[model samples]
Target: MFDLDLWREIFQSINKNKTRALLSGFTVAFAIMLFTILFGIANGLENTFEKFFIRTAENAITVRFGTTSKPYKGLKIGRQVRPSNKDLDYLEKEFGEDIQYMSPKISRNYQVSYKKQKGGYTVTGVAPDYQYIEKAEIKNGRFLSLKDVNNKEKICVIGRLVEEDLYLKESAVGKYIDLEGVQYKVVGVYSDGGGDSQERVIYLPYTTIQRLYLGKDDIGDISLTYNPNLTVDQALALVEEMTIKLKNRFDVAPNDQRGVRIGNQVLTAKKRLDNISSGLGALIPIIGFGTLIAGILGISNIMIFIVKERTKEIGIRKALGASPKSIVSIILLESILITTITGYLGLLIGVGILESIGSSLERYFITDPSVSSSLLFSATIVLIIAGTIAGFVPAKKASKIKPIIALRNG
Candidate 1:
């Protein structure tokens, strides 16, 4: 089956029209190469986006309440809605076992100072659970404790960017910073590697943020996390039940009057991210296939021309007793060989480019742009199959050629 003469003939035929063969090979290579790069970029973009979101916590959820689009009851659409500490406590008691951590955040724009240095900031009030739920890492000192929250202690944590701007060094920990003219001790610092530049936030005990700054016990919203023991769907289902119960406890009516609002970033943002990733995974392949189809067409056109030129040669062989299977196999094998080599070369080039440019690409995008090994293997198989298909019609024509007619044409 592995005849040296057969391969020799193929080599000779390709050598006869070197430029044509080279151009055909290049077409296949270019298609595959372009496809690979696009796929790699898609992957890199997804990875970067996922990483940033991960720092905010994968399992955690965020809640926000604002004016609804439609009027509820007799109230206008712009009616303000707010939550309270009692609502947070109720939710915690109800879903504590199903959660990893919880926090209620209230944000305000204010100025902070340490010594003579001052920095403007967005201040947030959060419980100790904020650290776990936000995946926070303290660069120095410690986080807020229950004592801080219950006693309404005037202690705060600073963002990395804020620290550099106000302290000039990380040694600002254990020192007091004036927030809104009220002195609060700096307890810790966290990085803003999520690409938000940290927003210069000064986090304090939820109670301190409530009483001293906002002048109210009302909160913005609560953040919660569900246990990994359940599936995402299951966890979300339990949370939804708890959400309804908490809404009831807060005396939220059917139209949401006198009620607190709830929300989840894990359910909304994370779910959207999942949909985007899946869509890209499906879309990039379609693009690659379009390129492959073009390459297949080119290979097929050249094969047809090759058949036309070699009609007499093929007829003579048939007349001399070469079987139809042999003729078909020879042509198909030639196409397969060409497509495979060039496709592989294209894949290698694409991978090389991705390796060199992937990091920069990652910074620009939310996912990776490179294909997996299994995908490469699958693509190789597809290339070979495409080559065989391209050669089939010409091979069939050659097989059916009449010796007498072909001889006259020759």
Candidate 2:
């Protein structure tokens, strides 16, 4: 039941003790404000981690060759260990079930000209599966096809920035672009999540690059995506197994780390995410305890003091036939009203600050730093409940004191 008279009494009491009420409210508001901002920053850090990893396919792995550091099978140290088209075929044949997509990469820097515009760009030759391995989105036309590689067709797929740089407003698809003296037809225009650097290059058939530049079936590197159904452990194991086999095939020592460098995106992302989660787990409790506990304790102490200060008033009300329940209700209601209003004010200020500084914090790897609506709602409820309990103990004690004793103490 809504009691107007009781509410009036609460307001009158609060008006008489404005400084005490304000102090109590400030303690809770500060606590809630600190809580909201810390959580927002944590969420921002997590967003940054996710965005960084999501640029490439999670199951993707790359194998690059380097000079052998150890000798094996009479092959001296410092011999270059080069991966070739044969290596790509061997992996497909050996781990066909575990592999989803595979590609051989051959990269070179070339001066490209379209009409009158000329620019220096990296031309990477790759198989059709490179599209999925690189997570490229074809905005128009199609990516490299199997026919292009099989026939050694002089065709290329240009990135979004490539189109913008040389072609201007014109689309690059189906147009012939001069790479040095050789002209290659652009078959597709694609975009990448890895920013402008990734989108500034051109893609061609790996076979064409091998034939034109190397005059042999050599490749720069091998990229492949493991089966999506494989667990993180399984994917990592497959990479390790593949590395060992490749090292053995090249007559490199088993412990030669530099000879065969295999990088697993899945493993890297997992480790990073695990580290982030562990950090957040440790940070939350410290923030909660430091802020919330202090607020709770502050409010609790203040409520007890308020009851002690009003001992004479409580005694007078009791003498005037006021019930114990009525006395408790006034104090509890006053506490709840103050906590609810101040808590919400603190929440609003915290969220506003996050939204305002969100863009600037991107340089620090902090993305959208704000709390969810549901969490805000929960915090408000918690503050109200905390306020009620803080008030109840002191209110109950004050109600129990005899009128004569309260009068004497006052």
Q: Write the per-residue lDDT of candidate 2 for residues 1-410, one digit (tens) a residue.
A: 88898888888988999998999899888888888888898888878777866667877888888899988888899999888888888998999999999999888999999999999999999999999989999999999999999999999999999999999999888899999999999999999998999999899999999888789988988988999898777888998899889988888798888888798655767766767778886987588657777888888988888888988989988988999999998889999999998999888888888989999999988999877889777777877788889999988999988999889999
Q: lDDT of each structure?
A: 0.76, 0.88
lDDT tens digits, residues 140-232, model 1?
888889999999998898887888888895587888888878988888888655555453677899899788867889888788777867666
Model 1: CA > 4 A from native = 1-15, 37-55, 58-60, 63-86, 108-110, 135-155, 169-171, 174-176, 180-185, 193-197, 207-220, 226-243, 264-337, 344-378, 381-410
| C-alpha RMSD of each candidate structure in angstroms | 6.5, 3.4
Clashes of each: 17, 0
Instruction: Point out the worst 10-residue segment of candidate 2 by lDDT.
Output: 265-274
User: Candidate 2 at 142: error in angstroms?
Assistant: 4.1
What is the TM-score (0 to 1) of candidate 1?
A: 0.64
